[model samples]
Target: MRALDLTLVLTNMPTTTTLRLSFSPSPPRPLSNRACPHGPVISQLDFFAFLNRHGSFLTPLSCCSLEVDRRRRSPITMLSYDSTSNVLANQFQVRELNDETDFETILSADGRFSVCGFGSLLSERSARSTFPDLVNFRFARLNGFRRVFAHVTPVFLERGIARPETKEISGLSVEPCEGESLTVTVFEIEKSEIPAYFEREIEYRFLAVLPQTLDGKPFDNPAVLCACYSDEEFLRVRCKGSKEMFFQLYGQYNIDKIWQDDILPCRAYLRHCVLAAKKLGDEVYDNFLDHTFLGDRKTTIRQHLATKGSGIMEEEPPESLKIRYGG
Candidate 1:
């Protein structure tokens, strides 16, 4: 009776540690399971270990559990509030979560807006910690977009997610894709608070998007949020002229490095993001697995989780940045 989030994820578990990719704009290192000279290169083993530990894989939590429990299959995805009515009942439909996109509507009301969240902000705990007064904290989906962990950030380092000893660090971002959607959180903040949010999300592009409710209906208005994509030209457009001014206001540096750099997701932050998705319920968790990807744009979080889910989530963030910066 749980709704399958975004039904997507295609990954092949690599047997070795060294990355052998055949793509031009590849990540600077291995997608994951990077071969460290000091350690054994074991990836798939971690996945099986997770299965063994959990006994029967639970729905939404396990990797690709939508097709699980062949003996007890059921119809009807979940019980969420109706997009239009904000009421829940048997007629509550999963179909509404996957709405068809109308580009014209999205473009019409992008400017005067509030904020949306796809990454850490998806966590109400993290959201409230950052924006104490955020209101209308609700779920929405941004169509024609997919979330990925492609861009680099020092925040990971400061959070101790990225230690100096590990493979370089990367964070999450959203990019344009056809026939794709992600469950994101949207909230309203005072106009006076925009500067603080901008600074917190310095290395990102403020994307204007039309967000929809669980039942395939658009919000009365559009929203703008830092999508953390790596398109400089697009950043210029979204920056409202002079990306430099935008950066200065946000107190960000290394603009070129943030985009052009290659790094992998820190286990700690990756675990945090995946756990955040998990908190949104089974559907949102599955949606995250299906859409979220490593920097390569080829590796799925499901693929990674399937093999090393236990270790990654259990692994501790490095003391590199925390010790250096005192976070």
Candidate 2:
């Protein structure tokens, strides 16, 4: 599969005019409804009609299937069907293409570094706080690694301190898994932000990775990978949490008092990661849920909710855990 950066162009036109969009480094091919094999062929008139009706609700950089070189690939593009001339005008004003050329300059320029984030950093809100001048971000996959909860953190260790009898909990890490691939968000930010990012990730160590987009396009620049708790470290530190604790906290769907106190922050972080995945859309989100692990197993939010019920019905975080984690 090939990656294409697309641009939408609208010429002086009337309300009934056809919408036209262009792709850089490639020309537009005949648009087809590849989504449905036996469905009616989508004509320009049908496309325009649908756009005029639902255009306002559509996100500017939404993903859509396009036939390219005899294969279907999803390219980042803006397409709108507007009933009014100003609708197109308004949409274009709000969204502009951040082209690959600009991205390359930002990547090659000084005071910039590429980091692969697989956790809370995947969230736009979290990443934006650190890198206000974030150049770009995209979905990428790291092969030969699997995410796990193998690193003992200060917060969990603090919990252990408070209740010396309670088993210690650990945070997330990536371990080598031959033939496995871990989905990550590869983004570029100013070098000035590196120190703060590292501070937040005190347990992780940086490793170099040649990042590849989901479509197998290798990034030109090497990405900084933050990893923790290799097999050796896992064995030496015995960072694994009590299997009993894992089942009690995450195995069921309900939020027990212990879960609210000890597991809520981590669950909150996981929610952020899920939100980021959702922003990428369903296919990407499904892939993320499939590959990611909570403690020891891959579980979906639906499964969690079915088991635990909603937060509204759950009890508050226990005072002890709140004070311990400084929540």
Candidate 3:
């Protein structure tokens, strides 16, 4: 039998306990331990909550094997055990953490932080490049938002894909809409790996959202977060249109001074996002087409797909782009 060692600290109290469990492929036996007289009851109660959530492997034990470490401590960092992976297979439930959730608590809780992707990140390859250690790369739906290719960004220009002449200089962003939901990919990454992530997702402000699983279940954690929408200030400036908003949001990036309505999506980037969705399966592809829209928010991707414009999203990147940008 292999022993699983778990050390926990209860934020609601001031105590620490180290627990050890011996595991096998059989039913669990009733195990018991006495809480140290000095330890608070919270130290014992939260222990049960943790175990209860880890599959149906353990019953509501009245007591737990606890070794008191009386010295004050920070939240214990999570240690992964092989036996726990199976329990994590379906972690779509409500999170106990809040918006101002403690970093140490979040980082140590199995290192499970979610990132929502409704655009190019629908591609596993694209997402993995940013979050190499990501796990549970799965699909979910974000309610109360809709996708639109209206965020004017410098990334397209940096990659040499912008068409300022045709106003195809926009990336993707989401806007709040009552009773609307967008299909998106949700994946887990360690909190420690996100410094570079902020750089890649510089245009949008990341916020915590509870995306619904395919089966309509809530995720166990709400820290599944990423930048998908503009902040209030950006929205206020965006009223002047995509071009004006871009200038206000990023001053130095506008070296070319070529700003426009951003009525169309960046050709190369849009095509990449569309093809990535297609590869996820029919549902995702259909969702991308039916739910996505241009800056006007009136023309759907599907409607555009029915026109000659479809060729832009289906054909290869331009010859000039090939020298600068790969698929």
Candidate 4:
């Protein structure tokens, strides 16, 4: 294991002063008895450059240190490491460091961290369209949550809704089930990408969730259930129409209106989602249907297609809008 140590000291003086940095190999002895191979002192610019070059060797929380003097409002920095000579040979084991508990603990401490994706994000084309920075994704399941079609978008009549609700309301929101889990494609993203990720889910709220991998182990990252509906909305929709009536109304809406305005209808968008799930194999497709709401009811993909008819499939999306499902 390669390690880095840096120390920054600031003075209490009000006027500007030079910041001092000390870098040394780990002790058998302290810096007083040793000579820094890089040199005794380095400029702030050089220090940043060195960090850029060797940052991967440092642990997640060990790369930098900042201390502020409340009295003077001054800052202090620190860095320390043994030697860079054997760094490559003793390179850090990233995977080992990413153990489930530790990874979850680190992210949970930040409070504002989460990784969650369903609906169009489950499809490669839609995901890529929305999150260009997303690179790796895994099939995971969120327990105690379900999918619904409650979010009303201008283009698509409805969007997937995930929230805690009772079975008596709309069947779209995930009800409090004892053992059921909602299937989702969880993306592994850098901490910096979080803001942009939530940007696409503006209507949703992040509910902390710990998703499990297909093999049943906890995924080694933070996740959230992105809920697009609330308790009030669920009850309101329930009073408005039955599931069959909702679909009937949806079917009568002009699909071309969406296409002419360069948008996708709810059913057409759903076709892409179904195709993506089918590509993931039977288990995923079935889980998707069992969890998601079609109008006011929960129906299988076949039933949805048969009832909605080919009109929902009328608008063939351009290749760019189509998703190539699976890895």
Candidate 5:
């Protein structure tokens, strides 16, 4: 059999009479050495690099340094060996490391840290060329949608980071679906240090994968409800409750105005949604519209492009009266 080499630092000198050795079948055996008394000794297992003809294998023992204070000497020792192998599959194993070694690697993956990191990256100017082409969409509006409008709120709508970040947005992201639908996961990278009443700001990140393409191109006039304020009509979402509800309510409210011909200012609405979504956590939820837009976004955009008056004013003719100077 192959021997594994291991060394231990002795605080209390171990004469041959006091020395002892133990072995566990799981790790094979450590090479024994009593040949040297003045220096470090090598074990037989350390001599050969064991080759794996097929399955996976673990190093015979745990490698760690042993500290000796008496003689001011520190030596290395092996503790345990663990491995996993499958006859027809690849082998895998998880080695348990010391607490100090493992924690340093995992700290960055914690929830709060992720939120803050994303928030920092988002605060900078966003690039706009990444989105798809649209007939009437302005680059500026697209930029707003990507960075501010569609983004999540810093405060989690569900209270904690355990729930997806998407819960905080307009509140329309997550819901039960029967047919083709979307699943969105949202996370807040950072909650702003400032209190809500003071500035009410947050930064967030969100992601959604949908089975069907939103295909905004097909809708006669698709519009993003964008944002809203603290009002009962907008789903009664308090800072403590579901922010997703707020987004849903805001969308419905906008649609109400569209049907009533009391069209709200699109830019203002978008800006509000952007800021509101940020404050809720850092991330917010949104999805493709299921129903028709109460108002036709395409029609509105066309009107803006034409820049012409409609109805009676369009039909009216200019008067023949001419201005006279110095008559």
Candidate 6:
């Protein structure tokens, strides 16, 4: 996987068009399928149209440019990395690419990191196969999303797996679902089951499962990467021995937004938890308004009466979760 510094990335890039950022704390604008008056909205159909013409989704770095084009008509860059990973897997090495390149940066440099790695079968399956097993062995714990800030932008949910596999290693499969924004509950401290100051510890949890799936069972070895920021520093934390190690300084941003804001920090912490869980290969626990459970490759659990068999779902009551969580 390739990573870059945000400061150098922003400074080295040349600005082209004027960009405007709007943050509305009010209820989110209802999603519409219609075209926007300002410009045509890019949808899955538009994304696939570009794929049909180009043979592959736009490169991650290239997405930044497409996003900045104010008068894009039938513009051809992809926004999401879902399809891009497999399409570019052997063809591309992220580490070899320069920091200034990416699809999202080209779209809107001002785009806030709303979770990207959600809502797909292929991406979820890749995450399932590549991540590690959580100590609790739950499926909901297996997945999560991250906040990515990109100046450039492209189509969301880009295409990747034009094909599917036929294997069942553990009879597990992550089903497809719609997107939802939720808070993070899990925390990866310097050590697990040990107490520490909240500042020294990292808090996070999963966001949503992209509508993608894998054929084989979840993989035993999954690598997770974490980006952490406090008022003092920003760093990447790599998972190792049940705990993630922090390294590779990613530079810093004014926490003024983070500290002055309430929901942003909470959301960031939740995103961190999910990102770590994805690396760890643990199933994420989805907290629907009324219930929660451990999801596996094949099943969604509702009761303790029946076990999902992946050992991913726990047959525990909701009260148990409340007690363990103290919420």
Q: How do the residues 1-327 of candidate 4 rate in per-residue lDDT, one tens digit apiece?
A: 234554444344443334344433343211110011111343333433443443222432432333322222111122223343312222222111112332343354333344566666677666666666665667887654556554344333233221112211122223223234777887655556555554444334334455667775655544655553332322334224344543443335422111011111255456666667777789888887666654342444456566643554455654543443222
User: Where is model 5 poorest over a 10-residue stretch in terms of lDDT?
Assistant: 139-148
lDDT of 3 by residue, 18-83 (tens): 344433323333221211111123443354444354322232122333343332211122222224
The C-alpha RMSD in Å for every predicted model, in order, reads 17.3, 15.8, 15.8, 19.9, 24.7, 21.8
**Model 5 spans with C-alpha error above 4 angstroms:** 1-188, 192-232, 239-261, 264-303, 308-327
Q: How well does candidate 6 match the true structure in TM-score terms?
A: 0.19
Best-performing candidate as measured by lDDT = 3
Q: How displaced is residue 183 in candidate 2, in Å?
A: 2.7
* Model 4, residue 65: C-alpha shift (Å): 40
Q: What's the CA error at residue 178 for candidate 4, in Å? A: 4.2
lDDT of 2: 0.47
Whole-model lDDT values for every prediction: 0.54, 0.47, 0.57, 0.44, 0.22, 0.23
Listed in order, each prediction's TM-score against the native is 0.56, 0.46, 0.58, 0.47, 0.19, 0.19
Candidate 6 lowest-lDDT run of ten: 150-159
Residue-level error in angstroms, candidate 1, position 33 = 30
Q: Tens digits of per-residue lDDT for model 5 on 54-88?
A: 11233323222121233112222211212232112
Best model number under TM-score: 3
Q: Write the per-residue lDDT of candidate 1 for residues 1-327, one digit (tens) a residue.
A: 343345333233232123222222322221111111112233333432432342222223322332323221122222223335433332211111111131122332322235778877778777777788777789998765677676667766545556445554677777655456789898876655655655566556554555678887766655764554434433454355676765654337343445432456767777777778888899999998899876666778899777744477665445643222211
Ranking of all predicted structures according to lDDT, beginning with the best and ending with the worst: 3, 1, 2, 4, 6, 5
Clash count per candidate: 4, 7, 5, 16, 31, 63
Q: Report the lDDT tens digits of candidate 6 across residue range 1-327.
A: 233222222222243223333322233222221111112245444444544343234443443322232222223332232342322231321110012122222122233111222221113332233232212222222222222221110111011111112111111111112232222222111222112222222321111121112332322222121211222221222122221122211112111221111111111112223334344343333332112222211122223114322222222213422222111
What is residue 160's positional error in candidate 2, in angstroms? 15
- Model 4, stretches more than 4 Å misplaced? 1-114, 155-179, 231-265, 295-301, 309-315, 318-327
Q: What's the lDDT for residue 239 in model 4?
A: 21
